[model samples]
Target: MMPFSTSFASRYSSAAMLVFALLSAVAPLAFSAQPADNPQSPVLPKSAADWRHAAIIDIDEAYQLSLENHPGVYDTANPDFLKNLQAAKAAGLALAVRVEDAAGYVAATQAFNVRIHDGHAGMSHNLDAQQLPAERWPGFITVWRGDALYVYAAETGGPSVGAEVLACDAKPIKQIISTNVFGFQGRSDEAGHWWVRAPRVFLDRGNPFLVLPKRCQFSLNGKRSQDSLVWKALSQQASKWRTESYNGEQLEVGMSEPRKKLFWLAMPTFAPDEKQREAYRLMLKGLSEHRQKFLEADAVVLDLRQNQGGSSEWSQSFAQALWGKSRVDRRVAAYGAKTEVWWRASPGNTDFVTGLVEVLTQQKQIEGAQWAKIQSEGMQAALARGDKFFVEVEPALPGAADAKLDVKLDVKADVFGDPPAFKVPVYVIVPGQCASACLDAIDVFSLFSNTSLIGAPSSADSTYMDVRTQLLTSGLAEVIIPNKVYVNRPRKNGQVYLPAIYIKDLEWSNANLLKTVEADLIRRKQ
Candidate 1:
């Protein structure tokens, strides 16, 4: 993942400008704008057919990179995975051939990404490449609730909050969303994809391939009505509100006593920035200091609704702190014993890992840097040995003589420090947005006998892991590809963890969420 840098836009913009200048020099006519016959008419450049053909070549390069370096290409779990990818590539090329402008190109690429159905495989355009005319939105946004879409936010005179959206553009609302929104921005899990992208169903985010709705039907107060959609430019505040509504309120790493015997721990993010790392350390320290408080509580809610992903180590460390290092380690060891991992030893993947070592070292993440260094060296060694993959299999437990290991292990003597475990009932609040490291947290927490998962089902990821970004040959966009594949992982690829207690009617606001959980705990006790 890219670090949070203030100058990222400027740096990318500069690079885009350079690329644009080069393209102009190579094809001056393609770059030059032709004046319109009428002054009021919009001046248009030459058809982007030539540019589109060039982008097709770039896509071909991306396809080759995925085939050579991405673990997903070699996924045996999904027999049709490679076929689907090939089909998506063919579809994208066909779209590129027919597209007349940048908007169509964007749609074609996004459609390709969505069709792949992998969260880790996607394209990100550079800054200037995204400077096309702004996409308009109807004066409201909708969210999935129960089996229906509801108006979550709106401009003045738009649909009222809680109004059920029945249809848009004379088509059933669900059909419209599935066609326009999901068709362009969907990922692995259905619930998760909806949770993350449904809010944009009414907006056209620079995809001119689909028609924008001009009218919508709503059902409110037992009265059905069709309203003319007033299309308008989305204000910055509205965009912010839409994001917050979908993601729920932002949270920091902290614990709160929502009730006399209920503790709510907000772990909104596990992002691996230096600040977040320090915050996690402090949170762990706080947990240790208030260990008794958590132990005595009737329930402890570990809220991960807003967490997307980061380093999995954060979740593992949290588990170690709460469940005791020895217990956590034993479970982790057992899990690892059954799993195997293979890193693609392609030159590009090896170089990416080598670069990560330097980046992690500069960020003061010594542990991460060391891990990257090891991976880099292993990949280099594998390449030298003419091996396609660097394989690793976990060692068996002390007495498991029947266990067959695929790789040699450097076993170290275990020094067990068995801290007392928290005996209170624990609940992990997972929303659909929980993914990657967030899912890792669920993996660790689920190992405990006293813990239960609640709320919506979490998003899923394939065996592919450890992604690296590579710029396409066209310089118009970059592709993300995963370098390693996990074999025999406990959780199957594209599998979601369904909450033990699913609260379909629960509102995501902090206050309401706490109240609902508290009420649920009360009912459980009764």
Candidate 2:
């Protein structure tokens, strides 16, 4: 969610910059300087001497630090947010003996983070921190799907795709998802997001009940199978995964066959780029030219499986082009009534004020043209009165029945445009990888009368987003905390976003899933 920045080095005085550096040491982190609310804040390593300064954090200190410093505990509007933190604190305390090393500390905090159940809040072990057992968890990638654990993709000679796991160390697959996927990962309702991930974490961390042995047992296509996985070096493992390869290319839109009457549009990201934006416009032009063909087509596949996220502007642009100008009212109506969202400025966080202006303008709560004038006036007034300026945002209710305008009378002008929407069935392919703007796209696309979502449940749309990062006192890890809670229905109810149609056969592989969609579309036509 880091916004595209033009070096505004001239904007801040050296004194103000110094204030921010000092404030970072103590100020409460909330929303970062990004509009979509998920910016990755910079995390710097401690002094070289400090790296060797080994200190043991007791259970009491750990719990107290989490309660005070965790963004999930302090920034969320959810009433039960505190209760969840307290429960995790108590649970971690009971297991405090494990906190002897940095790896153990990460496991403890990660468990606490998962309990918060907001995907926006997380901790990344400092690159210098001791590696965890799970960091070395063998090669297989397991995905959790509706109580069943299936091998989606695996390293060569590892578990075969489609293999079902009956148990790990004799615990049922259901228990693994409940305790490890949902419980330990803090994924809340998004089990599919952590299916393949939880197995590795639980096995390496020595989770008391759900641990996986070196030699695992499972069933492949209803036939019993076993595999022995050996520990592989990090460099070797990294190479095996091919992190440099482009997965999106595998799902890219192919040439449209004029006679077939079906179109596949693969959106790799919603992040704003001039070329991508132009490409989007051309796509709209092409679709509009084929109006009758699109209307009569069986389905148009909006591939968003590999999209991590980007600016919401791209999503909004696509929406306007697809539906034409008339449907803007209905689209705005889906947001429901606005709810109060609040934030306080810290002495050093001038960037937040900038971000606030952008968000308010986008939400139509404030006039965009006068944002600079208003911000300047507001700051001067607050300074004169010797008062800390507090900002509040009113966001429309997300996907509710009584949806009404939040602090304004109308939707943003950009939502309505010249290009009309394709009056055909839209199938949005969202695998577990979707988040941020991708989730925002889901919200917009879902409003269409003919749109339907297919694939696994998406990564939990942690409505509480935009991280403010803080370095742990131990210097072993950086806690990424989300400051703003998106005022949406799902956040209030503690739920994850679900697809309209859950595809059972499609595993984690994007290539396999896209092919399945093509086959399903072809089958429907037949």
Candidate 3:
């Protein structure tokens, strides 16, 4: 983490320079420049501001917007409304990237291709997105068999890739994801490549030092396979992961240490009650005091895939103490015009006008990698304002409730200082269980150049608003109504994840998950 200089600043044009500047913090992977699929096709967006508009509007904004414009419309709706929404989304995708600077997403960009029905009683009826013809990255044999593990596709190349995860490192894949895979958890396809992580816990294996890095070992078929796979490193690739007791009680701290300039802290979750505020500070203090230990390693892996995020304030503080990069400053963007309309349209009369009095109207609110980040930044000024500016509205009128309403609000405070430089590339491990404020952290981490998403997608995107209204329905009788967040996104392509890597569960390979990944990483380290 030293001062840096651009080696090729003179060569890039202004636009390219901005692109470079925006992405320089990211890896050197070239941007699609053109959209992933439609290269050379001038499917330009009518407004360049559209993508920027989508990126800044968080779930709070989208939900508030939806309550205003489309009252009471949750995932359940009339077929045509869904149809039109899908159609409009296609147009948006064709017009321009709805998400700008959304490159470098590991698992989010390309993970899940198949969509299953609401019920997943068995694999027979479910669909795996990776099986879709379009999603198959030609030349690989990845298939999520009914068993849940990816096996070799008969047609694509064989499963002869130097390393095949025979098992989930040490633990069974069934055991690793079983607890959280239930329910309407979401997943992505863009955050791909958990294959690179070498941590043995994920692989559940103990490979000899001879089989490191690629963790290649000659298989019974006379070929070799990757001895272990690191799930935490892969979470940044888009899938989320975390470990817990079979019954869901909190697990204890595992391996964390200072080696060669890094401290690989494998945290299980961010449950607020788990550790007192002072305990957290103590851990940070230890890491800081032991900076020499951390600095010795080249990078660090803060694995939190299975981590159910709690205490946004606590999480925010922890992240601040860690990398403390420029994530806060650069992430600020304007709230698009339409966002204002959606806010005022909620079911009730009074709106966020009072709450938003301090910030610019028709503007985007500040968000850091954590929730209530304003408090963490020591911005008592903004915190003082946040406490004062809240909207108290009257009940909705029976007759007027059905129509659309819209309001505009602005955000004017800084919650995070900026994305801080990490002494090492931090690999954020996430699973479908990691969500809400946790997802907020993911969103921010994705913006940094040195992060990766590994593990399965979290459940946050599946309708978990902080404030929800229970409604009447045939099946559940009463349910959470306004809980659904409206992304203004058309239905079809609006699924949560689009990842950078794709992983076939280790059960498919008949290997241990933890041992496999550990063996792989140990081999690499050697």
Candidate 4:
């Protein structure tokens, strides 16, 4: 199963499935429907003007959805988000008027999604279904190391692997990346954003809006040289390598003895699928069996370098196994007291929650099923009462008379008893791409007294979450819209979590990572 952003909990809800089913059923009708004048009928663009007009309609629809449903638009304290939204819409419309082809129109719509500064809010289409032109890339890929960009991989006759890229087309390499890559993709002001998107600088992913560089200046063997660019079709093998490099090695989910007294728990992803779910269950069971060994270990490295996100509850379960459920619950309750979640009461969102309840129940995720049920009921009531949002307050502490556990997994009380107070120092390895439920994992680990973050700052998300998609009228793309907004959350939107111990110029390979972390631990004890 594919990993998703933090907004994945309700992704496969009945409402979403129903929408997809309807879209599929009506796709034929939409294609062969009446004249372009009919708003309900999909416009098959046969000319440049037709494509531009269709794109404008789609952009307007997306903008309206955001205004009506996105919680960020309603945040009075952050008026800039609204202002940016308006600007992006205007820019997209203006660009649409000038575009003469499908590629141009796609880039125009992408501008709106990019300016939102949100990873969850974007326009995406299935390339195979759309039969779009394939993406092209220069015969090399670059990665960020220290403060400079270096070639990580190269085809024969391309830049050397260790070469530092200085400039492209006489423009500074950083400037080129900021404009061509991040500008068309979503742009964020956070350092983690740059770190995550840096690798895409040299790849032209079918966006006609970008101007590919003609020549690049590279410094190798202490000598500077320039080479003319040669764009080639991106091969499947090359594409796979690029993705793996950016996301890090996909390690198995289990604990290991990396050293005599040091342990390593490699949890590369928390993707919520039957196989991954079973893997997490078995890992937790193993942790339970070896609880004493971990508690007495010198250090434990919770490796999350490649984790993008999935279900956050997986990480919470891990924390509960080692830190004790009562302790973790109390910490969560204290944090929850100061926070609230406001789910939009729109018909689509309410419907999504209703469907989510059924899906979670079938999956045997009792805690999530119960939470979805509460939200579904609350939203329906809010809609009936003419309220715009349904509010959910944090539950009281565990021992309180009205205390309710938000999430209770299948850990038998008698089998594991109350785990002793964990005293081992946990070093969490977070890469720049760590986000969504991955960020949730960081939050869980931080609650413990003996935890310290290492590596780089993690990518951040806004208070907006739990996304649902609406297909554009053109049927070529879909717009992702978030349903819930956090009120008084501990971390502000776009705020990254900085690691306590930063590893400078650290290589991301598995062996090097373990060696580096071990060396750091030893030096600290000196």
Candidate 5:
């Protein structure tokens, strides 16, 4: 039988699911709708005309004006070098029109990206984007019972959908969000995504999670009713539920006790690891054997609010296990003009001949050789004709085949083939800190059936391209390179392809997207 507990969170009611697809009665736009370019953002050059007519903004100059130009990068040599290269590119940033402050920088960057169609690129706001009314975040937290911090809540369809704050700054995220969201007003609650995420458009800035302090006090609407003793025990034992592993790619696995029937999984990276691979296998196996139990659960929450992303393999695995099918066909293709045509190389290997004279195009390319090499630029270097042979591979499906993409994946996402079958509702939780692979994960996963995004908007819009560069400074220890990300498609094609559910702000800040299924299962058993 099901026993009520105040500590357990995110239960599903068949009745609730029926109405879950709706948006909140109050227009979130009031707080969320801010003009492009926040005042706090840096002013950036817009058009080629502006740059030519105005002061020359070198990569270093632009660095001072970009969102990517932060001190944290300097904390370590690797990040510092990356930021320096990023800074150099920032100098040459093409703007629609330069605005006054940081908000303007972000606003113009986003607007321009949308125009050219670059979404995966990053954007920083200026005064203009920051001009929206300040929003308020809930101080308390609502955690759906799980191993990670995933606390499930309804996809925002109404005011009642959010978690109720029970304490003053009582959750780990509350403090962090407050600290990291640099431009946000104390009251600003814009959940952080751009208005339009198109090709070449850049958006998403700041690391919001690191700021969240460790301790937090909270309460659950449903968790308060059951046996006080056991419920209290669960609450006191809350620390045991907290777990994180930088070593593993997958995260969180738990069955909600209060919500009894729901199951939960929170993934935080695109990089899939061995443990994560095994956990996923086990999860699927468990579901197969307990199909009745699986079918019985009211909801299943997949929490990824803190997920930064790991691998394309994991994304596919996730689609298959949950929905039992995918629509994408698995084929890889690439189209690029190679001056050195005849020869094509694979991921590993080396040496190439560009009409014989092409020993190496750039010093960069030569230094970063994949494998083996020709003796020299000797014209005699006719296609090494040696036992040495390398296959050329480009993006027929860059975003489609994300394995090669670092900052930006090619268009289709890990290459061609689509996923099959996915009626199980999905709720993606994005935060202000969401970027790169994390944003890609959100965008790609949204294509599945019954999918909705909650929390904050993505820091990136899936637009534009960024050139990865490594700085040449003394501490420059790693390679800094930028990936130019261009948007490949339009937004809102159809309901099946859209986010059926969305949450603007976390009133209770509990992000357990799938556990709602488990919670329902438990309740039903009662």
Candidate 6:
């Protein structure tokens, strides 16, 4: 009836509905029950003294506000979203006993966000007001090693590397993981990534809020090591140590070795500035020049570990350069998932006009005649007639209700460039933390049989994006949330994108990981 197409309907579960709601619309909901912040707002605490002098009520108010505004928990139709909120609430009951003052509230807020486990959902606090854990955990760097938390690196005091960590601060490590959740995006491996900073996870230097214990008790290799923490505000202590900086390069290309026939490329993020954009162009130009060489290389390892995401344009462009001039039928091979309108944007529900325009344009999925009609009718009129528009697809996996939609849209074919597709086997090495555009690369690459994923599974691919930042009613803190939601390939409740090779021992050190992968590549060549 509304330009619906049955061509692609069979691929999607019936329950998927696409809806759009901006975070700004919830400003009133966040502040309505709380005191408003303005020029005359309460003067925020300036230091630890000021924080001590400040009222605990303010911190509580901010914490409550963040909880109410968490998009994953508050307004989403996704059933999993609420479980996070429930977990946080249950954890809060235990935390309440520990919260003594404003600092406690800040810690509670962070714990709340961590429990939610969506990387995009986070709280920003006033750093000057709260005293942060200045020093890091002494000796060993703890990480989630496979299923258990283990000491992956040693700087000074604790167990040797490879020893399993039984507990911390007298609490069993498994118990800690079960009670307090710390992670990124929607994947457990990404959550493990945050755990790698263990005990460090409790320290936020600038936005001093989370606090760690003065000492941690560890049982490693059947022996207990009591590691005492020496706290120093790292910012004040200027040490001679210098860590290498990757500088957020969007696209990096090179070879593992001069003698090796393997090529290496790392794309940390796709959100590029002018320089990064130019660099990507230059990379394509370079690839074009060495087209034959690249095609002839034994294999190409595309590193997507640190790619937190950016514009999809870069992903598309890269695919064109590599895959070149391929045609994909969206109705068949590419019908990964679908979006359904779970909520309408009428006046009774929300600001109808804004909602209609966003739903029509945000996804870029709707086009041709129906899109033009919506445009001609204007947003207000379209809302009156109940017309919905969607643009490009977002991230979402099929749910139980995804199969029953009354109306559906035909997916468009994805057509690439005219260049010769790079026939070299492409190995996508994703050691988790990949999202947004990085997932976009996976989607496009999956179409080719030559492409294979190696290393750890990725952070759960979030179709939900467009993070909206809002200052809390306290003015001392802000909350960041993603207003958009996407559908993804259906997965088990806790499942993630598992790599084909499934390298369990990959470490945080990129150099170490590269060496491991490089060795495997050389063996493959043999």
Top TM-score model: 4
The 0-to-1 C-alpha lDDT of every candidate, in the order given, reads 0.67, 0.51, 0.31, 0.70, 0.31, 0.47
lDDT of 4 at 513: 70
Clashes of 5: 149
Which digits, one per residue and each the tens of the lDDT, describe model 1 over residues 1-526?
2211111011112222222112212221221122334322222224687557755765676677677777777667667668767877876777777666667767778777776777667665543423566756787777775467788878788888888989877799878888788777766246766666666787766676777778888998998978898777777867876776675776777777776878777787766457767877887997778777777888888899778775566677788778777676566655556566677888877776676666667767555465556667888999999887887432232232344322233222233455556778888888877777688788888878788887777778666765566666555565767667777877777888888776555247777667667777788789
As a whole number from 0 to 100, the lDDT of residue 159 in candidate 6 is: 58
Q: Write the per-residue lDDT of candidate 4 for residues 207-292, one digit (tens) a residue.
A: 66778889999998899988898888888867876876674566787778867778888888876457766777888998889888
Identify the runs in model 6 with alpha carbons over 4 angstroms from their true place.
1-42, 45-77, 80-102, 115-117, 120-122, 126-135, 150-158, 169-171, 177-260, 327-333, 336-421, 487-495, 502-511, 522-526
Q: After superposition on all CA atoms, what RMSD does each candidate show versus the true structure? A: 9.4, 8.9, 20.5, 6.1, 18.7, 8.9
TM-scores of the candidates in the order shown:
0.82, 0.68, 0.39, 0.84, 0.38, 0.65
Instruction: Put down candidate 3 lDDT per residue, 1-526, tens digits, no spaces.
Output: 0001111111112222222122222211211233446443323223336323432222223223333433223234323433433332333333223343322011111111012211110011111332222221122222222233333321223345323334433544434333222111222231211221112122211111112122222243545454332212222211221122111223344335434444555555544334544456676777656555554455555555445553334344445455442233223112111211111123221222122222222233222111112212222332345422122122232222242222121222223443324544555555444544455456545545656554444432322122322211111011112211223322122234432322234321212323333444465579
301 Cα displacement, candidate 2 (Å): 0.9
lDDT per residue (tens digit) for residues 74-132 in model 6: 34346676676567545543444455445554555566556665555555555344344
User: Sort by lDDT, best first: what order?
Assistant: 4, 1, 2, 6, 5, 3
Worst 10 residues of 3 by lDDT: 118-127
lDDT of 4: 0.70
Residue 519, model 6, lDDT:
72
Worst 10 contiguous positions by lDDT, candidate 1: 3-12
Ranking by TM-score: 4, 1, 2, 6, 3, 5
- Error (Å) of candidate 1 at residue 50 is 4.7
What stretches of model 2 exceed 4 Å from their correct place?
Answer: 1-77, 90-97, 128-134, 137-139, 153-161, 176-184, 199-215, 225-230, 234-259, 272-293, 344-421, 472-475, 488-493, 506-526
Better of 2 and 4 by TM-score: 4
Q: List clash counts for every candidate, in order.
A: 0, 12, 155, 0, 149, 32
